[model samples]
Target: MQSMSTLVFDADDTLWENNILFIRVVDDFLAWLAHPTLDHAAIRAVLNDVERANAKTHGYGSRVFLRNLADCFERLNERPATEAERREIERLAAALVFDQVELMPEVAATLADLGARHELALLTKGDDAEQRRKLAASGLAAHFGSVHVVREKDLAAYLALTSELRLDPATTWMIGNSPKSDIIPARQAGWNAVFIPHPHTWELEHAALDPADTGVLQLPSFTALRGHF
Candidate 1:
């Protein structure tokens, strides 16, 4: 609420299209499988399970996503994949990882507006190289005071960042799409949180906020965020 507030923005869905890209890749995989009897919903459910399990072991990014698709197919089919099928999956995953980063509508103007008014920083979680690549490609990097790439978005991670930067929790704000990662953890750290919901937010990133916990401010979209400042 203060003019000098330190604002941390999540880089993925908050600034650009991330989860939707993964969804598109998954759809392509389903089409390639072409299983007449298998329900798409069931396969997606299995794929989600595989992704979570594999994330714990292999961590996140394109390679882990490819492995998840491969493991899910094998689990459902009860057989090893053919060389051609493996190649197709690898090609699709590579395309996704290497694809140009696309910013959300009005993101550039919105970030520019906010950057002029406050201390803006980027706080994103994922493979360091992948996150940096996306950030660099976004072309909005110059607006930020600092950029942080973390393996996870949790209370401890935020705390560590704040400590290192010497930011006061009382005057800092975290703005992002994920309630599980962006809002809750920021609020828990005694900082302000603004939730900007994205349609394709990953299921693993979803969480319900208590009605009594009215600290988090929810906006319909990123463009609307400029009004708050």
Candidate 2:
């Protein structure tokens, strides 16, 4: 049997559908605004710009996303957006965080199997209440021994969590899709990492992993983790 270890997972796209829901809201908002001069791609660029900047200043969550959408509308829309349009943005944001999202294939089963042998935990970055809401909705909270929500998932935060949990960097593993947040920083923090790439991960989370990132394992899917752990 493999040695028992701590397995920390990232919540959003790493475990379940997240950005896709936000994408839907963006598409809906774009449709409503229908910028006269710009097509969807051009219009979305404005929103993307807003998100990237706002993420630095405001951090992240449904509320921030909703605000980003409104801000983008005001920036791009030739005419002033009506209160109805603003309300619609709020509705979409509420629906996303307030409802249960579909978990990735084999997530529950794989987490169950791993949790049986390894100490499982969560290290995800986002707005605290929204992340908690998503975790509570996911129905996999019991599998985790601890959960951490942070404003950012940089190397410092990783180090903080490692110290907080008293985890052995040699034996603990970080499992998730975001190369920027989950894989890179965790490895830099001296933890083992397993990368399960998700096609729908947020654009902001994309970062190329160092080809020589030692102790980093890439798997085909979440269920494939059963083979390694």
Candidate 3:
């Protein structure tokens, strides 16, 4: 087997706690919509519909999620929001930004150790602005030699990165939390994939894969990665 020298990682839930904040905010919004004057199920349905419709337009992140909340409120009330309602939404959205995000224990140490031996890069999918901010805040930014933030993680993106970096797929590994966005595509592109499952990954990010995808390895924690390479 070829020894891996280049390592790529997905941001967001892979390195830090992210989706949990979104889920918490959504749960709070649902609670607020459960008042006597509102139909909880109807409100949830409208929010789901708005999310499905706007997901492509706004993409994933706190901003898009806040927009969905605003749309859901308007649909529920059937009128423009009062100042108080608007303030509440803004407050909740702002709170989501500072919800105590932190790197998983051992992630920083593992990355630092791995970087000493490999060409480490971060390849993530999100709004570039938010992704960059998160990386900078996490203090993991400096460890990576390269970073790529794109709309999606597909075969083309993987191929392009390998081409641009002049990396051999056989010796490159992609580590991430999402099977749909990271593992499947990387495996398809003939790159080694390591799955580090996050506790709060979104349902849409899940994907089924063949058992023969032996190049795709799953681990309970990032600490286990030292042995894989």
Rank candidates by lDDT, best first.
2, 1, 3
lDDT of 2 by residue, 80-145 (tens): 568888777787666565458789998999898998899999988889998988899889899998
TM-score of 3: 0.88
lDDT digits (tens) for residues 1-229 of candidate 1 = 3477898999889999899889999998888887768878888898999988987777778878889999998988889889988898898777676447889999999988888889999999878888888887888889998999988889999999989889998788899999999999999888888999999999888998765776788999999888888
Tell me the tens digit of each residue's lDDT in model 3 across 59-96: 87778888889888888778878889888988877866
Cand. 1 Cα-lDDT: 0.87
The segments of candidate 1 whose C-alpha lies over 4 angstroms from its true place after superposition are none
Question: Where's the lowest-lDDT run of ten residues in candidate 1?
Answer: 91-100
Query: How many residue pairs clash in each candidate at the backbone level?
Result: 0, 0, 0
lDDT value, candidate 3, whole model = 0.83
Worst 10 residues of 2 by lDDT: 92-101
What candidate 3 gets wrong by more than 4 Å, as runs, is: 35-49, 76-80, 98-100
Q: Candidate 2 regions off by >4 Å? A: 78-80, 92-94
Candidate 3 has its poorest 10 consecutive residues by lDDT at: 92-101
Error of 1 at 54 (Å): 1.6
